[model samples]
Target: MSRTKTRFAFVCQSCGFRSPKWLGRCPGCEEWNTFAEESERVISGGSSARPAVPYPEIEDLSLSRIDSGIGELNRVLGGGIVPGSIILLGGEPGIGKSTLVLQAAEELSRQGLQVLYLAGEESAQQIKIRGDRLGLAGKHLFLASETCLERFLEEAQKIRPNLLVIDSIQTVYTESLDSIAGSISQVRECAARLLRFAKGERVPAFLVGHITKDGALAGPKALEHIVDTVLYFEGERHQNHKIVRAVKNRFGPANELGIFEMTGQGLKEVDSPSQLFLTERAPQAPGSAVVGAIEGSRPMLVEVQALVSQSNYITARRESNGFDRNRLSLLLAMLERRAGLHLLGTDVYVNVAGGLALSEPAVDLAVVAAVVSSFRNQPLSAKTVLFGEVGLAGEIRAVSLAVTRIREALAMGFKSVVLPANNLPLAEGVPKVELVGMSSVLDFMEWAG
Candidate 1:
């Protein structure tokens, strides 16, 4: 008789980094105490080889997508859900990941499509209650409350549904692996199996994934790579607005965003996100500036607010919300060096009106204007909008879609715009909006004063 062998390894909970011995910190994500030990059974068996087949000639098969009856969702999914594509949807707990999936499934079922919902985290009764509350009474929509991957796959094959949705991937477990559900091994193995199933059956699948404390997908990082598309549901749980953006999409463009407002019935699509973001604006408020920003091809007018005051401590504190802190520091330094705002002893704080995060450099000029307006206690015109990229050398740089931004601001009843000089030619065709082109940060400060 031969003794069976076992192999032991450590896996990082943060990034799935594997190591033979435990280390004080994970080299992958530089986190401490995140490693978990796991054992692998070494089986004694002869490996079977697969038979080879002749390669068939490639043919042109254009993409075929299914609409979920939700226009905003279809936009984020690049028109619609692609056949056989596995989509991983992740977000903070209670951030509406489950709600959005349920809504989409219900809509698809209404369109005469058979939808199979595999609920691992919730019971069938709970799901039915939610569906009832959402007014979902589709006979074609089927539900199965199970955590075993094998059982779910069997039921899926038996039903042969047009679409499949796993309420969550983190809760599912497979009997073949000894690891518990949500473990690194279990997550990776289950995701791979589901991807294979979706591809073999040519059915689009949506998997809800749990998020970690740091707001990343709570599992092996490889789980994100195995899926065809990755979508992130973001927004404050207490807030009414929720944003869905595609971080990775093999079939369509990345960074595409879809906006929604949470309501009693379910998630409602926001037709005009820009207007919703600026609905509570105060008139003629000092330190408030409107920025014409383009988020995923949609032009938006978002309010940027700044506060500048004497620092109580020796070192001035620079804080930001919905904006980058380090970028704020650089912009402040530029303000002192070039614009001569004398902000060295001032504590600066910047915030976007809504919970929307602004990353595009086009809003740089707006931040500067807001800070200056706050420090001087002067209010910018309520009808004026500003957008331009500010450089370290204090020069203003042109941004893309200048005409689109101007038109969106003008349509929103804004009359004036401060833009980069180089982008003036692009917006010259627009007559209703007054475009003021500035070459440098100093020029903008002088004009505002």
Candidate 2:
């Protein structure tokens, strides 16, 4: 009997970079003190290689999607969940990741689909308590408290469930690698095995992933590449509403947004997000402007609030929430150079109401309007909405989907729209709204006065 030789190497936890020896800084991810030693058994000799097969025809193959009974979730998933797809849901701790998955599982089970939920961090009793609290009957929802990937797969093979959910990928480990559960090798290997199982069984799987302190998924970067879709929960945990944004999706469009309200029962889908965001907005308030923004295919109305105050120190402070700080600085420079709003001695602050992040350039005009309103202590009309991109030359540029944005503002009861002069022709057919077109930021300042 020959003993197997064990090979050891240091691996970076941030990325799956391997090294022959340990170093203070990782050359792959450029992070310090992130490498951990891992070992694997060295197998000798090679087995007979299998021959490759020809590819099968997939043009005539049509897939039927499974509805999770959640409209917002289905929309984020590109209509419905595709079979054999692996979906990774990541969020900060206590951000309702488990609650959302359990609710979806309960709904699937209610529709006569057997759902096997493997809870790696919690026990069966804990999951049961959560389910009962969520008012789930759990007719066909099977729960298993297991962290070993091999045994869990064995049980899954026997059950042949329609849907599979792993409470978390960080806590599950495979025995083949001599590493801890949350280590890079273990997480990567377990995720790979799960992916193979899902593809072979043609069953859709949901993976709950933990996030790092930097708000990224806690695992090797390759974990995200292995999944078909990635959904992230965004918002403060103390808040009642949460935003689910799809950063990556293979079957559907990316950057899709879903709104949900946390209730005593479970996560409730928000149908009218624009209304919810504007419910508590104060009318006739200075420093506030409404912007018609589009997230994926859904058009929404969001509030952009800005505050301009004299700085106590010699250097002015610039801070922004739910909006890019660099963009704020650029906008401030443009305002000072073009609109003659002397902001060098004042501190500027900007925030997007309802914890919704606005990355689109169409909100530029609204941000500028809000800042001007705050600086001059004047309030714009509450029924007016703005959307257009501002260029470095003080020109208002036309944005995509102008008609869609106008229609959303109209539906939200906004009477007037301030848009780029070029987009007026695109939105000319929209009825019952006053269109105020601006060719440049100077024109906007004239309109504001």
Instruction: State the lDDT at 435 in candidate 2.
Output: 94
After aligning candidate 2 to the native by TM-score, how far in Å is the CA of 231 from where it should be?
0.3
TM-score of each: 0.93, 0.94
lDDT of 1 by residue, 290-366 (tens): 99998876899999999999999799999998889999999999999987889999999999977778889999999
- For every candidate structure, what is the RMSD over all alpha carbons to the true structure, in angstroms? 2.8, 2.4
lDDT of 1: 0.86
lDDT scores of the candidates, listed in order: 0.86, 0.88
What TM-score does prediction 2 earn? 0.94
**What are the runs in model 1 whose C-alpha is more than 4 Å off?**
1-6, 41-62, 220-222
Off-target runs (Cα >4 Å) in candidate 2 are: 1-5, 42-56, 59-62, 220-222
Q: Given candidate 1, what's the lDDT at residue 268?
A: 94
Model 2, 375-405: lDDT tens digits are 9989989999999999987899999999999
Clashes of 2: 0
